[model samples]
Target: MEEEKKTVRAVERALEVLLCFASGHEWGLTEIAGQVGLHKSTVHRLLATLEDKGFVSRDAATDKYRLGLSVLELSANLWRSDDPSVALLPEMERLRDQLGETVSLYIRDRAERVRIQAVQSKQAIRRVATVGARLPLSVGASSKVLLAFAEASVREAILSDPAWPSQLDRSTVGKQLDEIVTVGYATSFEEREPGAAAVSAPIFSRSGQLVAALSVSGPSNRLTPDRMHEYAPAIMEAAHRMGTISG
Candidate 1:
């Protein structure tokens, strides 16, 4: 005979209490106890635990409890893994067609920037970017944009590490990063690869966290500094639109 599977009653009850908020309504302790068929003290204990862990929030004045920001965070993580780039692909293609350049999506991964998606330009002479390519987080437009908008601790850790260039001009880089923040975009010319130039902007989550960089790249001859400045507004606009659909 097959072994019987046992479940923890306390955990089951806690989950049921959480599910009660699925109706998008707040509940008082006694009301939740009645809904889950538990004692008032039991429900109150469950609510305390969940609230402490950020799974629920309580209104002190009303003495009511509701779902918390952590629930949205979990769903956002799932959506990011499965659908972020997919949802942005159409916008990427649109930008590529409009600018006649390659449009790529980059996310910072530790000390590198990973190209998770790209829509290459139709022109034969244009720059080619491969999806899943891992490049340094030190020189490209997308690289600097990612670093400039990264968490303060993350940026400090990477910049202070000996692995980074020892001769880097700290003052200049600081000002450049500050400018990126003020302008909402970044540009580079032959900084990562000879004959390559690009403009990039930050894509942010609904919670205002920097999630990725949206970039347009091409040959330096075609993407001159003046042209990059001209394209910056479009890049920033696309990034803003992309951020709206992100978590």
Candidate 2:
């Protein structure tokens, strides 16, 4: 039992050392020990084990430790595995083919909307936002649709975060959110990225919980205000189909 306790303690110390890199700063053994509340010698030993496993690295000249490339690679692999991107690929493709533009799937993580999947159109003038890109919740039509349908507590928590970015047109967010709920979709023209227009609708699970958002984006010239009004119903219908399949 003593040996098991010692092992757990060691693991905890190791985790603390790794977490010390969360500030995006490099630290020497003494600094890490002070932050983690462990002796310098114990911290050094833990760092050595982590370095051997390629989870941490030390700068030879400064003797300061930082996260290693292996850690980043591992994180990327895990993110890909856990992402909703794979599940929404076929739907994205269908949307792209139907709209002759870009189709994207976005999900809210904390206070941010992350693009989990995208299918580009075959047009010569296609939009180029890639999968895995992140956007602020206050910026895009897709984000507004997502926030509008999210649980009240979740939306409140997101709005409560101090790190959330400010919106360019702050006055529209509240009104747009209300419209998203009332009309079952959201539309925008050059809201986030200039020269881009989008229409988004919410996807729900079998239990009637909002899971994510589906959006069709294209050049502003091709996606005029009149065209967006016409496309809103189509986007909403696609969202319903996605919900049925997802359920």
Candidate 3:
């Protein structure tokens, strides 16, 4: 028990030291120690341990430490374990082909929905979202799908935000969200981006948590009201495929 306790405490201290680099600035031993409230010597030992593991690197010139490529390697490995984007690509491609419009996958990050993957339609006039593009979680079909299935606390927090886009009528949006949850998908027209329309459905993890949202999007001219309705089932089928395959 004593040895286990020591091991846990050491792990915690090491994590605390690493977190000092969260500001993205190179950190010196003194700065890290001060930030983590540990002795400089202890911080140095922790940094050395982390450096050996490739989580951080020390600059010989400035005697400062920055995050190392090993950290990125670990990040890549972690995401690769059950990456939603990777699992959804095949389905997204099928949906894009079927709808002949751009299909994007989004995952919520706090107040934002970030596009992690997109398959563009061959149509010259079709809409496209770049991977890593961050869009507001308060608007659009993908964002609405996320909110409709998000935890109550997250939903309340966004709805409570004073600076949330003024044009989105919450009452009307609330009713629409209820319908989205009931129907298992969302549709939006000219809400997030003017002249664009999208249909989105939630992708769930094995545990049934909403892991991401998949969307089909295009210019409103091509995705008119009837067309959006027409495309809904394909999008839902793709969403289901993503959820089924994604861990």
Best model per lDDT = 1
Candidate 3 C-alpha lDDT tens digits along 140-229: 899999999999788878877897888888778778888999998889889877899998889887789888998888999889878888
* TM-score of each prediction: 0.67, 0.68, 0.68
**Ranking, TM-score, top scorer first:** 3, 2, 1
Clashing pairs in 1: none
lDDT at position 11, candidate 3: 92
Q: Per the 3 Å backbone cut-off, how many clashing residue pairs does candidate 3 have?
A: 0
Error of 2 at 121 (Å): 1.4
Ranking by lDDT: 1, 3, 2
> Is 2 or 3 the stronger prediction by lDDT?
3
Which segments of model 1 are wrong by more than 4 Å? 1-82
Residue 109 in candidate 3 has what lDDT?
91
The C-alpha local distance difference test score for the whole of candidate 2 amounts to 0.83
Give the backbone clash total of model 2. Answer: 0
Better of 1 and 3 by TM-score: 3
lDDT at 140, model 2 = 81
User: Each model's C-alpha lDDT?
Assistant: 0.90, 0.83, 0.86
Compared with the true structure, what per-residue lDDT tens digits does model 1 show for residues 61-180?
A: 999999989988996765454466788999899999999999999999999999988999999899999876889887899989998999889888878777887678766786788889
